[model samples]
Target: MKILSAFLMLLLPALVFGAEQTLVLDVSGHCGSCKKRIEKTVKAVDGTSSADWNKRTKKLTVSFDDEKTNKDAIVNAVLKVGHDADGKTADNEAYSNLPDCCQYRDE
Candidate 1:
């Protein structure tokens, strides 16, 4: 009984939260503002639990519930905000809309 209880406790969180996926993508950006924008955009995606961006590395790490969202959705969200992810090109209009300092394409 004790063993069963322990097993259930370990399994309960996974069952309740659903399967989670973590992906690290090469995201383009240049500064602190870009990090904030990238993190905010990724986190706003449905099922995404958390997002962290490292400006120096230009990497965005995101965690989401796999049952609710997928990689394309997360990537699109970032692109929608004028940030390119995993080699995908961002929309021209959206990219142009970003502040001059936030643009990374030229760099």
Candidate 2:
């Protein structure tokens, strides 16, 4: 009975998590600062449960309540802050607003 209870407890989280849909964003930016900006902005978006940005790969992993938000909203959030994600081009006006060093573009 004890072992069965423990197993159920462990499985419970997996079951719940599996049911919650998550969106992984392919973000493009320059460096650590860019990663931070993208992560912070996306996580602040309403309905986002969690967000992580990988500096090395320039990817942003976001977990949100699918019922409340969709992938387009997540991508737009990042773009609003002058970064690009999910194959959508960054807002040129917003991108031009970022500091020069934060710009991830070729001359």
Candidate 3:
């Protein structure tokens, strides 16, 4: 019937556009430059369609193709750039290499 057809039409787009999953990452660092660095690193990953890092909350939002990449890979990329993400510890070599202003250590 007409009502059934209209209902199906309305539901179709939602079904098509629904994301498989949404990943909310906690990234540690401060300042706008940190945001840019994290976002840029995440965006470089092949399956990431979009990435954003918030300086205020130290959170990174990433949308990626699950089939092509995964959460661990994304987290590692940020870690490699001297940022702590997804609960993983930062890489010592990468952390030591960051500019002084970008360093989060107390020392």
Query: Number of backbone collisions per candidate, in order?
Result: 0, 0, 0
Best-matching candidate per TM-score: 1
Model 3 per-residue lDDT tens digits across residues 13-90: 767763445589999897778888888999999788899888888888899877778899999999999887888879
| CA displacement after TM-score superposition, residue 81 of candidate 2 (Å) | 1.1
Give a tens-digit lDDT track for model 1, residues 1-107. Answer: 99999999999988887798899999999999999899988888889999999988888899999989999999998899899889999999999999999987785
TM-score each candidate.
Answer: 0.86, 0.77, 0.79
Best by lDDT: 1
User: In model 2, what is the error at residue 42, expressed in angstroms?
Assistant: 0.6
Worst ten-residue run, lDDT, model 2?
14-23
> Could you list the CA RMSD of all candidates, in the order they appear?
1.9, 3.8, 3.0
lDDT tens digits, residues 1-107, model 2?
Answer: 99999999989986675345677778878877887788788878888888888877877888887667878888888988888788888889999988888888764
For model 1, what is the alpha-carbon lDDT of residue 84? 86
Question: What's the C-alpha lDDT at position 22 in model 1?
Answer: 91
* lDDT of the candidates, in the order given: 0.91, 0.82, 0.85
lDDT of 3: 0.85
What does candidate 2 score in Cα RMSD to the true structure?
Answer: 3.8
In model 1, how many backbone clashes occur? 0
